[model samples]
Target: MFHLLLVIIYLAFISLGLPDGLLGAAWPSMYQEFQVPVSYAGIISMIIAGGTIVSSLQSDRLTLRFGPGRVTAVSVAMTAAALFGFSVTRSFLPLCFWAVPYGLGAGSVDAALNNYVALHYASRHMSWLHCMWGVGASAGPYIMGYVLSGGGIWNTGYRCIGLLQIALTAILFLSLPLWRDRPGNGRDSATRQEEGGGAGDPAPAVPLSLMQIIAIPGAREVMVTFFCYCALEQTAGLWAASYLALHEGVSTEAAAFFASLFFIGITAGRAASGFLTLRFNDTQMIRLGLALILAGILIFFLPLGGNAALAGLIIIGLGCAPVYPCVIHSTPALFGADRSQAIIGVQMASAYVGTCLMPPLFGLLANHISISLFPFYLFVILVLMFLMHERLLKKTRR
Candidate 1:
């Protein structure tokens, strides 16, 4: 049953990634057809991220009320609806309107599933489940690329993916029973305890109010760590191609293609990280990831050969791969399992906010100063993330 559940979660993650990659792939065609400036995409993205933030923060409440299975079902359905709306829309305004549900749906599922896996599954599963997400993220662009290559409209790509999401939503709804059932045990919390050789009941620590959860020690620090790390990750991802093209003198097309290595590295690295968890704990894994990220950033800034920038981006992706999964997996252990849901919800919200805000902020700085400073911005965020995570760990341990 656990394995089955994992499979469903993996599929859900792929659905999440499908829409995510679509926008970037379709935006060029979209802007041309809609007669909007490329910068207008930012407004749609910000609206989506805003919706994600709102939904992620409220994920705990929704999951508690509807259960993860139903929430997952409904969320994906909402996203599918939003995508279908995008498929037929003629103007930028309608796209922005649909993005609200798109982001909301994605955020809720992300928070709920991360918390669920952290509580019920092993650390290795956390690593691998995220790898599945990487696969989905990569697949989205390919789907869009295929559509564009075949002379199909961007709306066709959106519609096809929306249909896929609808299919996944049906599966999720059917699998609702699996989420409700605990194999060979008591309730979900009891199952968690039994699987871990009795960590004791975690019921009391869960279902916390927002204020009460924030009052817990290390909560704010954890949120800050998420914000910084996500900022670093998204900023690097959004700008790596431009940075390579501008600074390393790489061709624009080559730079765009090479930037994908960051995500590929992340996916492949997670496959390896699942094995590493056997030898290292979550905290050690995160620290190692941070070290690698710092090294990658340093490589980015170095005056190496033409291929150096590509290598740096790949390395950064690899470094980023483990940190997110490890940090999420540690939530049940760092805070009580009872509070894991609430904490994870808020953490997801912070992550979205960072993802939404930092990339634009960096773009603004690049507009004013130099795009060459991208590496430096990432370095500062990485350093701050490390410090914040360490501080949070200390408080948790105390």
Candidate 2:
């Protein structure tokens, strides 16, 4: 059972990362295929956010009524089908239609898995679960780039990813015998006070209500910090490769290598963080992660050229490395276990705003100015995040 759980987790994390890496790698190709403006491209990139936001309205009740495994498997299936449909569509309208279902799948899996994990597993496992997402996300681009480079059609790359999603769904289906609907004690919900879980204990739960979750003791700050953190992470991710290609004049393959470095760095950092959190306070780690990200974004935007800038991107990746897992792991700990899912739902939905906001903002900026100006946007957001971090959950950290 334990080994099977590890396999499911590894596969699930790969699904999380698939879209993350694919978006950046496929951005240029999508632009060329759709012949859309950068603004539209940015909007398209974030359309899933809108879908996830809407579906979050029902995630809790849905999970409560149906078991997490069933919900998770169904959602993963939806995401896979959506991605498959998205890969084949020649028109934008149908593509938009597909985004809605994809978002629903995204929202559902997000809520179900986090809640199930927190309710059943250790806090440290929560870190590992999300880190799996980073790993999958990091690897996705390479896979996409490989297909494209090997003379495969662009849509074929997406289909390959869809197949990967199907594989993950299959694992969940096959593992149903082992997954518990009600998390065993000290595992998922055990740490929640209402569930006989202790307060202030580490473990993430599925977020329930967006409106209500934000009202919790330190949730607002976590959201704000997450907003800042996501904006920086997403912006750097979605646009950095374009900056390298369009501005630096690197080839598509070379540019992907650069972006892969960032994701790879993130994956490496997340993997280490899962282990690190077992012995440390997450807040302290968050602070350190934020500082590293701040410096990395600054380095990415600096006037330097050649190997120095490349090194800067690596540094930036290292900086961003721990911030996400640290913040995500902090959710259930901050909100308590039972309400953790609700709070995380709110956090994830609200968190999408960052993903939605920056890509378009960067797109608009890029349309008006140089891609060099692109890094400036993230750099500015990084500063705000740095300043905002202290304000985020200020009272709670004390």
Candidate 3:
């Protein structure tokens, strides 16, 4: 029963990650079809981020009332509806508008699922669960690049995705009955009490006075480190394709495929990290990851080096792959598993801020400068993340 439930959750997470890959593939078509610029294409990311922020903020309440499985169904349904909306969008404004609900749905699912898995599942499974997301994300775009047929009639493409989402959502909903029922599994103590629970369960500790969580040796570093890591990552995944398509003379289909390369790297890296955790501590893995990312980001921009740069992007993918999920798996141990969601939720909300800021910032940057220059910002963001991670880990050890 446990293994079956774990597999279902894994599949659900993979489905959730599919949009990351698929969205990039659709960008060029939307631009050509709508007669919009690359900057406008970037707005789609902002809109999605905005939706994530709203849903994340509300996630505690939703999970409190309906349980993770129910919330998961609603979020997945919202994602399907939004994907369908993207398919049928008549104009740019309509498409931009749909992102709100899409983000809401995605954010809800992200918070609920991460929290549920953390509170209930083992640390090892946490890495694998997110790996599923990476696998799904990698598949979403590669399929589109092959199947999109010159990026015309994007509806045909998106409708297929919508069908996929609907199918995935149905599976998730049917499996909803399998998720365990528990109150405050991932929230802070007070929040848990409001949701109803007894003292008998091995509750995650919470302080009565400060209201904010105190860090364990390594957790604070992990949280802040991930905040920067995810922010940088979300920026790259969401904007890299638009940057290429808008300015690099790459077709949307091709640019989307390039974007998928990053996720593919991430998928491989994350899946590897799932097992690697058995062999390495978070700090050692992170240091190695940071080194690769630094090298990879530079190689990605090397002059007269397309193939090398592509290889670098893959390395970047491998480097970026583990940090977020590693931090996630580690968070529960750092913060009591019970309060893992609320603490991580706050950190993830910060990540949403990065997602919100980067798209429009890059969009406006691309408006004035060039899309090539836009990626420079991501590079800088990554360096900052690495430094922050180093600092956070130092703090953790003490």
Candidate 4:
């Protein structure tokens, strides 16, 4: 049953990722059909991000009240409905409306499941589970592309993923019993025992207010670290092609294909990191990832040309693969398991905040200054993240 639950959780993560790439892949066709400017997609994205932030902030309370299984099931169902809504929308307005639930569903489930796995599972499982997400994210664009190439509308692509989400939602609901039947359940009793609690002691993990969570030692540092990590990741993913085309003089088509190497590296790297976690701990994995990111950035600085930029992006993606999962997996240890849910909730919100803000900020800078500043921008964020992780280590150790 425990393994079954793990399988279900993996499927849930995949569902969580399925919609992420859909919009970006379909937006070109969508905008033309709706007669909207290409920029309107950003508005929908912002709406979704706003909803994600709000729901992520609420995840601790919701998960505590309903349990992760219920939260996961309900959130997946919400996204399914939202995707279905998107499938039938003709105008841009309805798409924006649907983005609300789409975002809300993603945030709560992300926080709930990450915290759940962090408390209940090994670091390797965390890495593997995120690898599943990358698989789903990669598959989403392919599905959309296939639909478009097959003469089906973008709406058909949305409908296809919506159907998949609905199926996963049903599986999650049926597996709710598995969640409760597990020995540890929500807050692992063994963990509490290790923390000096008796076997029969009541669970100490009450939902914490945002302020209360922030007051914990190392909480601020971890949040800033998450923000910085996400800022760098999203900014790079968003602008890599443009930077290659504009600054490196790569052709637009070639740059677009090369940019995909970043995500491919992340997906493949996570698969490898899962195995590596058997030897290296979370902190070690994070340090290795950060070091690779630094090396990748340095490669970008070398006067090697467009090919070097492509190589740098791939290396950077490989570096990113371990950092997110390791940090999330370490949350229960760095903070107490009792506080992990709330802390992870805030961490997700901070990540989404960075996702929403950073790419656009870089766009503005690129417009006024130069796209060549991309590596410099990533370097600053990477340095801040590295410093924050070091600070987090000290604070948690003390």
lDDT of each: 0.86, 0.71, 0.71, 0.90
Q: Candidate 1 clash total?
A: 1
Query: Which residue pairs of candidate 1 clash?
Result: 206-338
Best by TM-score: 4
TM-score of 4: 0.95
Pairs that clash in candidate 4:
none
Candidate 1 segments whose C-alpha is farther than 4 A from its true place:
181-207
TM-score (all chains, Cα) for each model: 0.92, 0.80, 0.77, 0.95
Residue-level lDDT of model 3, residues 30-80, one tens digit each, is: 688789887686678878887787777666556655667778888989999
Which candidate number would show the highest lDDT if scored against the true structure? 4
Q: Model 2: residues >4 Å from true position, as ranges?
A: 23-40, 87-90, 119-124, 181-209, 241-256, 297-306, 363-376
Error of 4 at 263 (Å): 0.5
Candidate 1 is scored at a TM of 0.92
> What's the true lDDT of residue 339 in model 1?
73
Per-candidate clash tally? 1, 25, 2, 0
- Report the poorest 10 consecutive residues by lDDT, candidate 3: 206-215
Expressed as tens digits, the lDDT of each residue in 83-177 for candidate 4 is 99999999988898999999999999999899989988899999999999999999999999999999999999999999999999899888876
RMSD of each: 4.1, 5.4, 5.1, 3.4
**Candidate 2 Cα lDDT to native:** 0.71
